[model samples]
Target: MSSAVVGLLIQELPKGGMMMTRTLILGIAATIVAAPSGAFADTPAGNQQAQNTSDAREIVCRRMPPPAGTRIGPRNICRTQAEWDLLQQQNREEVERQQDASHYSRGN
Candidate 1:
C-alpha cells in the first residue's frame, strides 16, 4: 500500500476502535437484557454486609425490583419485603444504581 493509504489507516484507528467498543458494549447489553440476573438474585441475608444491596434485592419478594439499567429521578418506592415479594420475580426490583453524585436523584 502507498504511504497515503497507510496514513489513512492510522487516522482511522480510533474510529475502528470506537466501533469495536460499541459492538462489544451492545453485545454485553444484549446479554444482560436477555439473561436473568440470577447471579445477583440470591436471597437477602438477614444481616449481611451488603444490607443495602440485600434490601434492594429483597424488595423483589414484597415490593418490586429496580428497573433495568439506570433509573433516574422520580422512580418507584419499595419499602417492605411483602411489597418486594409482590414484585415480579424477574428484574422488576432493580433500583437505579446510584453513583456518589447521583445519590440524591432518587428523591431520597
Candidate 2:
C-alpha cells in the first residue's frame, strides 16, 4: 500500500486505537513482502524454459590427478558434459598420434 493510503488509514482509525493501527500496518507490510513470491509460481512457460536450459548446460565435476612428480593433491575440474566429451576425444587422438610416431621411429 502507498504511504498516502496508509496515512489515510491511520487518520481514519478511532481515537486511541494504537493496537489496531499497528496491526493494520503490519498486515499491509506482510502482504506487500509476500505477494511477489507467488507471482512467478504459476508461470509455466518461463519456468519450463529455465529448467530445460539448466538441464542442457548442467555442470559435471571431476577430480583430476596432479601433474607428474608433484606432491600436491589432485585438483577439481568442472565442465559441462559436452566439454568433457570433447576433451576425452582429443586426448585419445593425441595418444594415437604418439603411438603412430613411435611405431614409425622404430621402423616396424
The TM-scores, one per candidate, come to: 0.21, 0.43
Instruction: Give the local distance difference test score of model 2.
Output: 0.83
Per-residue lDDT over 19-75 for candidate 2, one digit per residue giving the tens place of the 0 to 100 score: 878687979877997899988687578888888667658899999999999999999
TM-score of 2: 0.43
lDDT of each: 0.55, 0.83
Best by TM-score: 2
User: Compared with the true structure, what per-residue lDDT tens digits does model 1 show for residues 21-83?
Assistant: 655655666676667766777755655656765566564322345656867444456456645
Please report the candidate that would top lDDT against the real structure. Answer: 2
